[model samples]
Target: MLRLASLKFGRLFRYGKLLFAASLLVVMLLNTHSLFSSFQRNELTDRRFLSLNKCPACFGSSWCRKFMNGQLSFEGWGRLRLLDFFNVKNVHFAQYGEPREGSRRVVLKRLGSNHELSELDQRICKRATGRPRCDLVQAMYKTDFARLNGDVRLLTPDVVEGWSDLVHCPSQRLLDRLVRRYAETKDSGSFLLRNLKDTERMQLLLTLAFNPEPLVLQSFPSDEGWPFAKYLGACGRMVAVNYVGEELWSYFNAPWEKRVDLAWQLMEIAEQLTNNDFEFALYLLDVSFDNFAVGPRDGKVIIVDAENVLVADKKN
Candidate 1:
């Protein structure tokens, strides 16, 4: 009876060892397969050459890089994230000339047609040739702004945050500076930003006088339909379009509807303050306030990203 029990016990121990070996082999094979797959994917994308000059915020750190590459889509916000990798803070509607790789080029192609963008929309579609195919989002407009010569002074990320925090209004000093500069340059007519459309061109010229900082605007010639230089003097007040360039709620808590409502409210305030017909513009796309080194233009709340204001006509 002892001999028989020993034989049974020996059989059970060998069986257990065999099962463990098989399980170990399976786990090793899975790990190898996973590693192989990752290597293959990396080879196909060839993202090694994509530099940080092309995107800083999204690709600045390894964490941002991995998260954006994996989770962010190749459309909408994803494309923006890719551009953010290069730290391009001011890819605005007025200043689009060359096509970017990935989804940004696709949106440019769509805008080239008259259905979404007007034929006269020379501001963005300045040079839409030789576009590349890349996985990115359709960028409408982008800009970065910072306070110059104030209590805050430096245009740090935190300072831009503080300016944007004031949902109902911007600093009175900033507003005054913009308006005063507009008055000085309304007649000069010529500025560094001759390519912008009517409203955008005027805004850029005004920005030059007030901020004197480099600003990117839409590309256009004088023959374009909208010529806003003549009507510059008849404006009052302004609304700083606080677009945070990310879908993060902390940058801008209000929805599109709320934002539009606020625009109207600001316009009313401008009318009451200046007692002039308050004209305003909306940079209704993702805009990075920190990207703009210059101050806001007074009197003219120009729509830097005019694409957001227009409703694309699918049927047309």
Candidate 2:
């Protein structure tokens, strides 16, 4: 009986050792994979920066030049940390301008996740060339801007009828107003179009159609009393805006009076946006605490995320 018990005990010990080894191996493999992924991501980001610098149709040319030249810098992309794997949005933080010129912290956003951007590219390619595998530059050159403009006009009236996926507005008058304002301000749009290749111009316009945040910011600039983040500039798909403050979600636990004030401010903003003297009524379709922030000094509510805003032509 003693010998049998010893044999069983010896078997159990060996099994436990094997399990421990297997668990350790899994952990090591996971770490190795994570490290490799981080390296790949960094490499990819570097490549994108290089491409942006070389592209003629760069958005916010001055800002892009500064970023590529190291006047503006950010932490290199690496996702080795477990928490980083959950960051689905292509957003980053960086310091803008030179220290001597009053550098400020800014938030950079790609306006969409990697997956979403990839899908957009595919759609654009297919529409331009009838094939998802076509060259993006060549496809852009082939895209008919006149046709796109016509579609934009048609979609404008559809916004009120709930048929448009572009800007939520009836009549193209609001879009025209924004474009005129942007052009009058001598913003990057005019410079970008001047002597630009048809391919580059098409690329720029298509990107705007996909995401109108740039247009919105330029038209309703924070300096002009718009309760939106101050636009710094953009490079390729990424846009830079001044970091307003911590998200409104972070202020939920503040004093009751402070919370009440914030609530009142938000309601006032809503009313102003809907009933402003302007010909258009701007409606925020997706409202969440995460999309707004309180000014660090003024405590004013600002819309940090202006992606899903809808502009409706009140006259129409």
Candidate 3:
């Protein structure tokens, strides 16, 4: 009887050890799952917050207000919307005025990638009086537009030659045209002030100094029959433009006749841009089908991307 009792006790002890080990394993798995779930939640929250917060600084306050008020909303990238979290283009498509007037599709460009913008911000902060904590307004005020101003004097067009990253054509006439167009569209006093304020204007000047796309679009406005995207307006670092259409690559498998016509149109566009009446030749350094697009309705070929265009003084 003593031997039997001893053997039963040993069996019970081994069973208890096995049960405890199983319980510990289950607890560890559960804890790991909880931790993973928490991480996912935190990541999503951070992305959403960053997207909204960057709007005011990226698009300006007025446009930020429009976004907050639901006057503008993002449009999904079809089935690829799921991967939008990984988008690197810094460009967003949005619908404008779905309630009041007919809805219009527009492209909002951040003008630079995330890494590029971050570097730009760092440079701006370094130049600002506020140092490491400076905002765009402070940085804008710190910019010396006078030093970078192109000559505007009519009497002696060659006397005071100032250079700018905004225009590379080196023509006072082109500079004047750009300035006039910019003022008419962007800086028309109080009425325009409602959309873009003093801080925004300064920011725009800084952008022109950094990237010349805004100035280029204004210099060759779509309204003037230029094969460029329409310069709708800017909020901050972001600029809104009329969405032309899908990229040229999308039409690769199109009808043979259509393909021939598109190729012809592209050649014509290149010819026109190289030898136009503007007295300056625009050499497209990055001439790729991806940089151009076809109009959805008119089937017109347009240079949707002008970031890499170089202007040369033809007369010289």
Candidate 4:
């Protein structure tokens, strides 16, 4: 009798434990508002730290000099993207700019970058300057910036579908400028923008928010020849073709949920863009909020600048 009573008690104890765990999960779900409130108040401050410790700069001048010298710039290859929680390719788009000294081909910009671990920037001390560049770069890649928070609240499906121009058309002035700029490329096969109506134009812009590869693939010419090759040879890609917005960094100032969505969306697009993709290796690494904008209807994002795109592989 005593053994049977003990067995029953053990069953009851297990049931109690399971009930406690379920109760804890519900509490956590309910406390999400408090957690989000706490994160914004403390973690997402205006302060931008270079890092928690000394690190080498990946996108800094040391790597850019390699690019200018016409060498493989693997240092600038993997950039941090929070959404996927991994580093991905960041091909610096330098086509159509100043020709590299020795090579006839154009290279991406040689922008100087200091990770900005400035005094008054934070409580953490400045990083030691003597660390090996490789170690610093690797450390920077490994660090996690996001403070633990609740899952993101995605934009509604109805709103995603509402990214249409039936409600609102893009600015005529902007369209004219974008069209004129594209016409300057004189890319014979790519003048389709001239015939597209405002709705079609808006649709193209909206589609860019998801991925720019389809447009890039479509821009490739049919008949193999010099005119199309020369145009691409000098500057790499047709810049200003896809750029629709002016500033996306401003979205960071919005509420935490909005900020998460904007950053996630941008990186999500970037993750899909293959730098060394296609028959001619296409690298579209030109990234800036200035090259993007929002739809007038549902405020869906768009990328404007395609100039930094590089297409390699064809013997010229």
Give me the candidate number with maximum lDDT: 2
For every candidate in turn, the CA RMSD to the true structure comes to: 21.4, 7.8, 13.2, 22.6
* TM-score, per-candidate, Cα-based: 0.17, 0.73, 0.67, 0.24
lDDT of 2 at 57: 26
Q: How high a TM-score does candidate 2 get?
A: 0.73
Cα lDDT tens digits, model 1, 130-214, are 2332221111122221113123322222322222211113333333333333322333333222222333333332233222221
> Which stretches of model 3 miss by more than 4 angstroms?
1-69, 77-85, 98-100, 129-133, 145-166, 183-201, 313-316
Model 4, 1-316: lDDT tens digits are 9999999999999999999889867865787676455434321111122121232221111122232343321112211112112212222322122345532322232111122222212212123233333344333323221111123122122322322221122233322323332322233233345344332333233222223332332354312211111112111111112222335766666788866777776665554343323333334556677556554455556554443444433221
Looking at model 4, residue 303 earns an lDDT score of: 53
State the lDDT at 86 in candidate 4. 24
Note the residue pairs that clash in candidate 3.
Answer: 59-235, 59-236
Candidate 2: which stretches are off by over 4 Å? 1-47, 50-62, 75-84, 144-166, 183-204
Best candidate (score: TM-score): 2
What C-alpha root-mean-square deviation, in Å, does candidate 2 show against the real structure? 7.8
Ranking by lDDT: 2, 3, 4, 1
Better of 2 and 4 by lDDT: 2
Tens digits of per-residue lDDT for model 3, 1-316: 9999999999999999999889867865767765454434422123243343433234333344454455555654421333344667667777777565778988777677777777766766677564655665445456452223223222122432333333544565554554455632335323222344444444435555556676678678888777888877655456677899988999999999999999999889878878887776777777887788898899998887777666666776
Model 2: how far is 86 from its true place, Å? 2.2
